[model samples]
Target: MSDATRPDPDPSIAELEAQEQRLTLTRFTHDDAWTLGSLLVELARQRQAPVAIDIRRGGQQLFHAALPGSTPDNDAWIDRKRRVVERYGNSSYLVGARYRAKDTTFEASSRLDLDRYAAHGGSFPITVEGAGVIGTVTVSGLPQLEDHMMVVEALERFRDS
Candidate 1:
């Protein structure tokens, strides 16, 4: 079939809704945020690291904590995490995947913008499998690798519990 004669691929309504659902990070509750924050603080202590952490539900702040000596610069990670996840509908890992796929512009620029992406930090989508995004956990105050690791650890703990 000629390219022009082929029908364009389009999703059914249910498929479209499912896709939208997966991408939607719904607002979290104050309680949920606080819980996640406490988990992060505890995780940081276990790692023996002084880090600043922020947890958000949708666009709202649910929890925030700065370890001793954490600076203002550390606090911005959460915002960056939110911005990246909000735009990409995926976690930092997914963003990294996109980078690997040669779609590096958004990921690269997002990492550079402190207001929306931490160079080494990660954004974890607080979502259930097939449910879409519900919130995010963003942690900073260490190398980007460490920051991402910490967030991953915290999410595992939260998810398992």
Candidate 2:
């Protein structure tokens, strides 16, 4: 694709931070988790995207699903990505982008066990108006960006609804 036809670059770290600020929820209940999780599942099915979706509040898992063609490996990825969100209180994609923006990798700089914590995309912090980051919503089985976008899109729709 020509430069003009090329997709825009991923948002900058500042832009991603702004997105986190903007996406905060007024409230998040168990029912909201169910609505959001079901929305994600519906969207993925519409796209025929094989993926695993997970929603958690602190140590409590609120919702989870493994779509057609998804595998146990996607569950592993969900855990790793969710760990990143829990640790940083930021979206996993934003954390990874921050490292990349500094011309480094999370694995190289974090000194954390790669098997336990993945700073890859797909996991987003679920921040409430005043509760801070109460949980995480994550997806796996797609490319990092696509996985992240899927969660983002689902959240936006949920928020609007």
Candidate 3:
């Protein structure tokens, strides 16, 4: 079937929520952040994706990288997307999807300053066992969906390894 005829590849809210639940880490430390961040950098390098990645915990940025083609704007996007994850304690993609499913955009429904917050994809909460969301992993410089998927892929790899 043509791509247009295929079902949307994006996961449903339940699926994304399950991801958040299932991907919980036993513990996350500075070293863990380094590993995850390095993994993301490697993935992006392999893909030749021009993206900016950021990982933060306890309100402190642990790692950040801007790939060759990425621009400063990507940093802004990272911050905005991270804010969504921070405020909602869910992946930014999930938050945006929930709003879209409700027949409204997050920009219209959230009533928050658009400059500081974005409901677009690319940020995932770093949830640990026995702790809620400890931080966020975010990417920018790709389409929102791609950005979100990249983070999810890295998180899965990090968890599995």
Residue pairs of candidate 3 with colliding backbone atoms: none
Q: Tens digit of lDDT per residue, candidate 3, span 90-139?
A: 99999999999999999999999999999898999999988889999999
lDDT of 1 by residue, 26-123 (tens): 33467767876898898788777778887776667778888886888777665765667666665654455445457454545544555556323456
Q: List the pairs of residues colliding in candidate 1.
A: 80-116, 120-144
Best by lDDT: 2
For all predicted structures, in order, the TM-scores are 0.68, 0.96, 0.95
- Candidate 1 lDDT at 125 equals 67
lDDT of residue 114 for candidate 3: 97
Those runs of model 3 whose alpha carbons end farther than 4 Å from true positions after fitting are 1-7
Distance from true location, Cα of 110 in model 3, Å: 0.7
Error in Å for residue 23 of model 1:
15
Query: Which residue pairs show collisions in model 2?
Result: none
Best by TM-score: 2
Worst 10-residue lDDT window, candidate 1? 11-20
Q: How does candidate 3 score on lDDT?
A: 0.93
Q: Which one wins by lDDT: 1 or 2?
A: 2
Q: What are the lDDT scores of the predictions, listed in order?
A: 0.63, 0.94, 0.93
